[model samples]
Target chain A: MNPISSYLSSSIGRKWIVALTGLGLFGFVVGHMIGNLQVFIGPEPLNRYGHFLQGLGELLWVVRLGLLAMLVAHVVFTIKLRLENRAARGTPYAVTTRRAATLPARMMALSGLMVLCFIVFHLLHFTAQKIDPSFLALHDDKGRHDVYRMMILGFQSKAASGFYVVAVGLLAMHLNHGIGSLFQTLGLNSAKVRPLWEKGGVAFSWLIFLGYASIPVAVLTGVLK
Target chain B: MNLHLKVWRQKDAKSAGKLADIEARNIPEDASFLEMLDIVNDDLTGKGEEPIAFDHDCREGICGTCSLSINGVPHGPSETTTCQLYMRKFKDGETIHVEPFRAKTFPVVRDLIVDRSAFDRIQQAGGFITARTGSAQDANCLPVPKVAADAAMEAAACIGCGACVAACPNASAMLFVGAKVSHLALLPQGQAERTSRALKMVRTMDEEGFGNCSNYLECEAVCPADIPASVIARLNREYTVAAVKDGVA
Candidate 1:
């Protein structure tokens, strides 16, 4: 392996990967949020958007594969970095607090892992369509899987809606740190632009969380049906 | 004023360390932090107990020798070095907890004394100017910009203190190594060996088993010399460019 590649494989390399893949995931979240906002336009438009995505077919699969690769790289790098940090520090002092980190930056890895689990459950509940065959069986007049109806029915249970709300909350947290971190990694952040980036990250994260969570919340409340 | 001290005590490099509580009364509040420790050691010696061994010299704070992790913060709550800290910072009757710099690469030699010679070894690996002796050149032979000179001076201000490592969550010495590398590599006199210098220093830094930087910024927060973490960023860029240029990447 090349020395720089080997260096990247080292602990520092892991950080670079986290920063890079984190930027990729942040872009994905923004795009996903925008697409999801169509739900506010009612089922017809939302369903059309879902169908368009489904129509991508092989391209969609490529995108999914790319995302999976990014996720695996992110998680693997995180675990490696965490283990290396622990080994180097030996034992920590008793007092640990959030003072060392900004609110969202501190729980980034934890929130990211939580969001990862939620994503898995989300795919099973909707994408994989295997967890609930009855939901998968529903179809619209256009012979499309009634993704809108599935989403509505899926959130009918308070437990399911509540889980989604928390998941979105965690996703927001992950985005808060990740968005700003991407700029830092790219060497774009400076004293002049850093505060702007920080505030912009917070705004972007909240927008994404609200956009995604609104679908579940609206459906559960019978406002979308 | 009276003070309660909890000092970490270890017999040797391999020994398990513990906090040994001791009481010292009527200490002057104006004493430097190390002077307070000195008083405690004097009391211990008077009692026929072995005085706690800690590293300190040139109590004015330039030497970077007085290493202590006070109350979970490296060199106490102040941004200054341990030797520069004053006894007045603590309240009367307050308990002061002191420990050596904790990291895998910094093994404890005794109470509040760790062998930081690993840092010296790493520095020795690739941290000097290669300019040949007595090769006299005119001062005006090489005209360098003032901004570059200032940047180099700022980077050169690093005193080789392990505070960057001590304050870092992963105990990364990149800030220290980067400063050293940047100081020399930025100069017109040092550009001839920049690629080789960065590669050799970075490899030596890793070989010394220092952890990677996570960019927590704690090193900047606690650095007595106030060396910026930006130097580490410059170091990363230099390393990448050098590695590529050298066909090592």
Candidate 2:
């Protein structure tokens, strides 16, 4: 085997790949969550932010492609790792207990898959305007693409709002375990600050969850309209 | 005290195993978990029935030979080995389930015994220091910092028990491999082969069909030696550095 293959095939190599890609996606979420909060500052700022992003043209596509690549690498490696992990335990335990494993930790794959579904549905709903015809038609008085109205209207429905809330909750749970684990997987954790990293993961995950969820929640509750 | 056990019974590795229920009457409270099995085996033998087979040695929690998944937890509910588990931990007439360490790489030798030579093979790959025969160096010649020495000693505490493997959802041996790697990598004497040691041991561990760590931390909780999971992080650091260096080479 070549040196690269040998290295990547090892467990540590796979973890490094997972951690790096996960950190990238993590950074994207933090930025995206904060950016989405622009809805509260009124439609002018939020729509202008959208217009500014659209003005970037080709640069926007490049960033999107990069994020897409990171997402693919993260998901593919996770699946590969999970398959190998499943194969390691050929026999299932008759009576198993979740003694040390937390709910989010154990539900990583499930929540991850849920988040994936949400992402797809989300893009279709907002970006492509395929899921909802109204999402494509709405515009502000300034003759600009009213992203702020699109978001508020998109989440005004009970079903869409509920789905967004549930998906974001799952995302939060995934981040809770994934963020803290990134340190360990990357070998950044030490005895001195292990607790800080672990606890910090929970706090950060919840922060992202509440931040993202608040937008749809505000629209549904008529706070953002 | 009277106890009931639902012990796993398998004819061989290729065959299926089932839980064989057995009754232990008048068991003393102080009897260790292994002793209770022994008494049960004796009764089975006297009755002209096949005795239950389980692995045990040193019975003192040091050999890492004894393995049992008692009541759904590896090494029972205690943070100690199965041999160290006593009847007093269970209430009278409590029903317990005993099963061998089940991992794809660790096939059951019999009922409760599993072939754990994979660990020996991993250790053999690079878990030691190799030096030429010469005059012994002075103890103070290579001074290791107290923190480094303590960290190395902590990693060295693993008893090679398969509990970490058994407890892991993916049955990953990262903790075991991590402990083995960190123990040597921390010491000044182990510096000569540090890079190669990390690379070789990790390859061997992967080849042994062990799973990847998913950060569940179950190994730390169920470990008989209470080996922390941070050693895994150190092992990750060591392996990455080695792999990157080797790739460059």
Candidate 3:
């Protein structure tokens, strides 16, 4: 038991927590992107899809609560690890040189912070409908919440759409370094596949950026409406 | 060649230190970095001033005792140990900034020398294996696979140098620990204690206050032995399996 506690507190242990939570969040992001892309399918299908999710009553809340728990754990463990990391370097070097580390690798904490803020604003904007209470009352011809219309209206404003694009861009950057790092942390990497995983991570992250940004771009271009 | 040297000058571990500008004149182009320091110390002794305190042994690349960070690199411009770095690598009159490795765990004992006993402690924790106390086993008695032997040899190449820690942005010792863990775990002799070794070593490593590996790979860049970052991945695997087993049993 003592060894287990110490093991969990170790650097590798914190990495497991951070890496697993990051993977779970990545799953949610991909799933959310696919679901939202349904907006391009037309209003009725999108609204019905939204209604079906709301219909799952307890299961939807369960998923929401699970996401929340994972988010908190991710944030808390990351902060703890970050503080330890900062403290480990007692003093700064007189001359700093970076030879092997990439910009994305060095900027994980910074990018993670930006993405977390975006998540907060995102929930306020869409899930709670706090940004525009009027969207809450919009019902389709079938009396279902017109989510497709809500999305179009949401992105019609240049500022909101622009902000969404930038936030997701930051998320993509985070994943640019994170997904490859996740493989290493989970002991899934070896010499032969390391380069492949790293390149794949970069490519996948950009794909997500395009997938997410396409909607806002479509809305602003008058294609999704 | 002449050069402007901004070297750290700490009296001792408890005192704050700053860079002292010392001019190195007529230094030989072929002189190793440590020899240059020797010439400077000799001149300082002639002037009745305190000589700079730095660590070195064997005056060759194999020993890991030299611990100066030259121009913000662990071992100067070369991909080798500081002792092997020569004066020719720098231009005439280059202002070389020399500082000690600045990890909190490897605190500055004096100018250009930090206490690396932290590494020794880590080594003692589990960087070893249990075997029968007897004469040397026959060479072919234990037939290790060529790949395993090569990997083990690679891990064993680490000289317990703290450069990995110094170069890491997080001051992590994962590269060093990874090397040690991988070195032993790859062999048949290390099988008996593999489980406890991973757990105990990691526990000790954490208690020593080294930071997490963020996969920056700076450690690999600065490692004199050229230990790859894959060792860290191997360490993660070893520790995960051990911890899972430990939790249930």
Candidate 4:
């Protein structure tokens, strides 16, 4: 109890909480992108993929519950730390020149909030199929869930696709700062390897953006249909 | 060198502060930044006016007492303390905006002088070793690796300057705490209270109203001592390990 109290009360402890949970979400994001890329393999494989996920049965729910917990903790601790950071600066400088904080680093909390909203919207649109009830019961020719058709139809709408692209773009910026910062938070950042981690983070974020954006772009151009 | 200076002016902590424009003429290029200020103060005093108040001690950069944020850069544009900054660094007609180190924990005692005793409180929290002084240990008896010794010395080089807080967007004292933590944690003498040291110092830092480190790295860039941000990473690592150890214990 003493340890828990001290740990929770410390700022560095909160940072560790944010970094560890962020790592979990980052892994899920990568796994999800790869699974969605299966759409390029055609309806049978993609539908089978979705079916295989459901095949996990109760384990799938456990993972979902775990991710939800992680998301809640990450968001809560982040906001708390952000508020503390703001209060720490009692007076703002009359003139400011950026010496260290990059644009992406400065926008981290804002982008994080937007990404949170996007995650909820995405789950409603795709996972629950509640956003568009028309896609809820559709099946492919193989009698499997027509996830492929739903994706095509979902992206066919210019507004939805536009919203998705913007959301993913914000997600990319979030990752651009979050990834390199994780190394710092974990104390793995060394002077020798810091630049590699920083550049690698930007590269990884752009990669995720290109992968996520490819789906909507393909569907909108009638390539996926 | 003739320079236009906008220096922050305040009578006391309760009073409001403003930047006062004053012209400095015929300053020697070899004169230090503080010396130039001295000349200006002398002229004001001669004219029966109150001289601008600022902090100073050793003209040498060793003492962390001298502090000024020159033109938005802490300790001026040079990679040294304000006392060590030379007049030659500025153009003849250039205008310099000088302000005190700003942070919630550090309140202004007057113009260009903030009460940095928050640092003393943080240091007192756990920045020392409590070894018995029965007898001096032979240097050969305690075998420290060269790399570890060098790193410890680098961390120990911190002069307790508040520039890191002034330079930080969040006004975090992580770099200062990081330096002290690494300095102690690296040495065998500092092993007795390593776990508790990390916990107490961090808790005190938070209580003192300092911000959490966000990896901005501005502190390292503006640091006159050049204490690297990697030290801060080490602080995070040490704190994490300590917390986990305490949790299991």
| TM-score (0 to 1) of chain B for each candidate | 0.96, 0.98, 0.98, 0.98
Order the numbered candidates by TM-score, best leading: 2, 3, 4, 1
For candidate 3, write residues A1-225 as lDDT tens digits: 486676677789888998999999999999999889888888877888899999999999999999999889899998999899999988889986878899989888888899889998889988899999998998888888989888999999999999999999989999999999999999888788999889999999999999999999999998888
Q: Judged by lDDT against the true structure, how good is candidate 3?
A: 0.91
Best by DockQ: 2
Retained true contacts (fraction), each candidate:
0.25, 0.77, 0.78, 0.69
lDDT of 1: 0.80
Q: Which is superior by DockQ, 2 or 3?
A: 2
DockQ of 1: 0.41
Q: Cα deviation in Å at residue B75, candidate 2?
A: 0.8
Deviation in angstroms for B98 in model 3?
0.2
- Each prediction's total of clashing residue pairs, residues at least 3 apart in sequence or on different chains, is 1, 0, 0, 0
Show model 4 residue runs off by greater than 4 Å.
none
- Supply candidate 4's per-residue lDDT for B152: 94
lDDT tens digits by residue: candidate 1, B1-249: 889988888899787878898887778999878888889889889999999899998888788888888887888877788988888999999988888888888888888888888778767777876777886899899887998898889888888779778777788888898788888877898788788878778777777778866666777778888787677767776776776688742
Candidate 2 C-alpha RMSD relative to the actual structure: 1.2
The TM-score of chain B in candidate 3 is: 0.98
lDDT of each: 0.80, 0.91, 0.91, 0.91
Model 2, residue B80: what's the lDDT?
Answer: 94
Candidate that would win on TM-score = 2
Q: How does model 2 score on DockQ?
A: 0.81
> lDDT of model 1 at residue A36?
73
| Winner by TM-score between candidate 3 and candidate 2 | 2
